[model samples]
Target: MAKKDYYQILGITKSAEEREIKKAYKKLAMKYHPDRNQGDKTAENKFKEIKEAYEILINEEKRTAYDQYGHAAFENGHSNNTYSTFTSSSDFSDIFGDVFGDIFGGNRTKRAKKGSDLCYKMEILLEEAVKGTKKEIHIPTLQKCKKCHGSGASIGTKPYSCSTCNSKGQIHIRKGFFTVQQSCPTCQGRGTIIKHPCNGCHGQGRVETYKTLLVKIPPGIDDNDRIRLNNEGEAGSNGAQSGDLYVQISVKKHPIFEREENNLYCEVPINFTMAALGGEIEVPTLDGRVKLKIPCETQSGKLFRIRGRGVRSMQNRNQGDLLCRVVVETPVNLNEQQKNLLHELGKSFNDFRGENNSPRSKRFFDGVKRFFDDLTR
Candidate 1:
């Protein structure tokens, strides 16, 4: 008799994905498995058909040949003769292992687990962030026991194989038609038990102790940046690999300067005479004091840019510019003689007339007059 179509046998379309094919096979295998069906001949035949269809379609090379030549690709002494034979119970067990491994913890191999990671927050001054510095931090963490060398066994003693799981670290429990594997209860999946525990750690293989670590802060590090120190976290159990430490940095506020990226900004107070008449004045920078030249007729809120006087770049060695905003200071608490001299100076400028000495104030008042006239109209 001619064989049935593979896609029709699996109840899937030719365009079905590999995962869909596996899913359909799993569903049918569960329903018609010989173990589930007992002595039913019809279910056994149907299970064989499903298994044969899955074997051909699951293999890329066989599926390609079957798609081109149909069932003839496996007939007449072809290398694909393996699909004609029904698989044994061992094959079903391998399939079950692949499908239910994660749910039942069926992995047989045992490996040591790494220690847990740790996080530490460090606060530093803005100056320290701008310039690199080293700091030592003290942390309380789990360290491997010195007396037992992380084995949890006392002197002249050792760990023995677990009796519950026979040192397999896992136990298999048969549930009807399926076998579920879980961690051994006695050893907690460690596969061994310490015969005599060390006095220091009491069978934990680690002890809580204070450790000092030195961390180097890189230059030009901004606030909220992080530095990772590998293998500096809690000690691992039973000679496993240690975890890592993360250091979070926070920069403090500066009194005189505000930093944005690589630039620094500050406001400088300038006398009214200096604004009216050009002069050189001293200003503060990160490096030291520097002379700033203010041109004649300089107004309040005028910004001055000084090259290479700002924060340095972390990636490259390039320096940034500094921005200084000038605010003209008004004279106050004048004596009688000073007031008389100021009055004489003000009279010389013809305050009542349209004098251009204070051009900004004159234009502002003229604009206000025009606004009022328009409102009346």
Candidate 2:
């Protein structure tokens, strides 16, 4: 008999997004959950099918292979050997320890563990972002103990092999007809236990200390960008390698300029006289102020681009351009003489035709006429 199609069972197309696939799987799983359909064999089988589909689709590598080659991608053999291995795995107690250690605690290996990664958020002025600068940072973390050489034992004593598991580090148990392996509870799976705890570290082999490091921040870094410093984190316990320090960048708000990608944007206010008559004005840049040319009859919100005046790309691209948006400023606090002059200027264009002179206005009024005509008929 032919097997059912996974996509058809999920009720989604081949080009469905990741979120869409998850939504479809969740809907089917909730409707056919085993506890909800206890006596129905059809619903139980459907629930199993949904579980198998999610187990494949949720994994990136498995989903890619299945999409390209179908179910044949996972047919290494036709045996229950894989299921037997899973069923005979460790019990919940030790399994929980190993999983939670990775999530909350640390590694369980006998060797020294790597230090934790550190994040530092550094703020810089816009001028500093234009040009690179070096700075110092102080961080407090756990440093390895120096008294007992990070061994967590007294000067004359050392750790001994665990007696519970006989130094094998794992215990075996028989359940029904299957044999399973579980981590040793006596030594916490470290295979060794300290006889006399160290006085300096209190048996942890580490102490709290503060460290200061100097970091050179490069130019062109934007908000949320990070610089990684290798082996600059807290000292590892015993002889393990140290982790890394990540310096996150944050640019302060500038009064004149706003950044977008690699480009800079600024609003330049121009008097109404300048909008009517052509003139040159000085505009500000990261380096200094430069002159910009405005044409006659320039309207408000007109944009002018200055080449090579923006930020350089951190990813090795050439410098970008700075864009200036012009905003026409009307004169305020005018006296009677200024108002009369403006009224005289307006009277010169009072004979302007609304149809031939303004095509946009004519088109809008024509559309309104047709709408009312259609409604009346």
Candidate 3:
């Protein structure tokens, strides 16, 4: 059989980024996983193909070599020949465990359970997102019990081996034709049982507590961006390591400016006189006010970009620009003298629909006239 295209197998384009590739792999892997599609030979083969493609594509070096030479890149050591072989142990839980959960728990963790990652949604001002800021957050989570020292046993006592699986933490189950080794039901895969439970954590080993952490918000952080704090999540089970805490950011909308990617956009209103004759106006920036000059006969909604005035990018360290859109404000609620002055100025033009005074209006009227004339014909 001819080897399938890796990008085609993952249902992603050639230009798909690493994150996109991972996302596509996770979705397909969850569907055709061996545990999910057991006894289905077609699904199993498809899953093997998917895994091979993912392994090659997810790595920077492998992906580059694959892109350059296709299947020949890994001809020497690639496991494409091992489609029938599969491994029982995997680190898939670190990424997709929270998503699939226990329902699709194909790759079960044989070791003690690690702490669950926690997500904290924090709303910050746009200014704070642009410039760096510090925040102190309090979260109620499970911590290792001080009384039992995270062992789940009382200060004086300790846990003993479970007799169900002979301290192996796993049991063999004969399912139809094959004997499958699975986690022991009696000990719940911990390999040990707590006879004398601690009064502080009551055998679970973790206690409820509130923790205060000072998180440093990085500059140029955008909305929906997350910052990870190591070992700041819930306490693990059976002395496993604690998981990480993800600080999800939500930037509050600014009154004067809106951010798009790295750039900032704001609408600046200019009077008809200022727009027609040209003048200097002050525009608001994150730091302070800056003067922007309006050119003569500047049209409404024209963008004026001020380079290096927007938020600095966190990744590339390149400065962004600030774009100001000018909108001409029509004169309203004028006095008699002002109205008379405007009427005289308006009369100065021979025809309002002519190209000299209003070129846009003249073209618009001409188009309208052509449309009606065509209709009449």
Candidate 4:
């Protein structure tokens, strides 16, 4: 019988990209693998077909020849015979690991272990976040044992090659036509065994210790920013590379000012006289206080912006504006004379009648009247 098209066997088009071809092959190979579908001869045959299709389509030269002459290109021994026979489980793992290593952490062939990364949360004041500061932090982590020097062996002794796996760190198990490779149970993939364990850290090459580090925070760093310190985390086993330490920053809420990006916002309460007559008022900024000029007849909830009085940008050193929202505070605890004077002032405004000084209040009352009139109509 004529062989099926490679693309059709892998359920992909002939114009499929390399990534698409690999993805389809991986899916089908996992689904029909003999190890996963044990005792099913149909699945075993299907897996072989998928593997053959992938092997040809993934290679430029083989694909070119196969595209021109189909399977007849390899019938009389023209092919390299790379995949003609399945010899060992290592060969199967090599092909599978090449495509899926990143998805499954890393290649299983690599037995060296790196130290685990660590995270530390540090809270700072808003002022500190804007101005930048240095802080010392204490972290409890694992450090390499001084006596054993991360080797896990006692004085005058060193680790020996694992007898179970012959120091290769992996063991192969053959089941029928399929074979599986796994880390050696005795050495745990370390490829070495310690006869005399270190007294300082037992068999483990690390000990619990507290580490102190000084972290320098950058100016204008916002909340939830992360600063990484390289190789400051737990010590790696067997002399592998150490991990990193990530310091996460949390800015505390300020009582007066709220920050949005580089800008600063604050609600400033002003007396009714100042709101109406206009005056210079003091507003707080990250850099001391600044005077903000309020225009005459300024209404409540009016915003006044002071340029270059806000937080500076860490990237470019550009400063932002400070926005002050004015809230008119009503006079309270008035004496009898003050109350009478206010009453007279209020009457004077009404006596002007045609002036319409309070246009917002007039428009609001007009809308209310129209609503009631519509209801009556």
| Index of the highest-lDDT prediction | 3
lDDT of candidate 3 over 209-285, digit per residue (tens): 99999999999999999999999999898788898999999999899999999999999999999988999999999
Cα lDDT tens digits for candidate 4, 268-305: 99998897788998888887888889887889999888
Pairs of residues clashing in candidate 2: none
Query: Deviation in angstroms for 43 in model 3?
Result: 30
Model 1 misplacement above 4 A? 1-31, 34-42, 45-98, 101-111, 166-183, 345-355
Q: Which ten residues in a row have the lowest lDDT in candidate 3?
A: 94-103
Tell me the deviation in Å of residue 299 in model 4.
0.7
Superior candidate under TM-score, 2 versus 4: 4
TM-score each candidate. Answer: 0.75, 0.64, 0.69, 0.75
The residue-level lDDT of candidate 4 at 222 comes to 95
Per-residue lDDT for 83-178 in model 2, tens only? 111111352223333333334443445445688888889999877776678888998878777887777787888878888877656666665433
Model 4, TM vs. native: 0.75
Candidate 1's error at 33, in angstroms?
3.8
Q: Which pairs of residues have clashing backbones in candidate 4?
A: none
Between candidates 2 and 3, the lDDT winner: 3
Model 1 lDDT at residue 234: 87
Scored by Cα lDDT, where does model 3 land? 0.84
Q: Candidate 3 — which pairs collide?
A: none
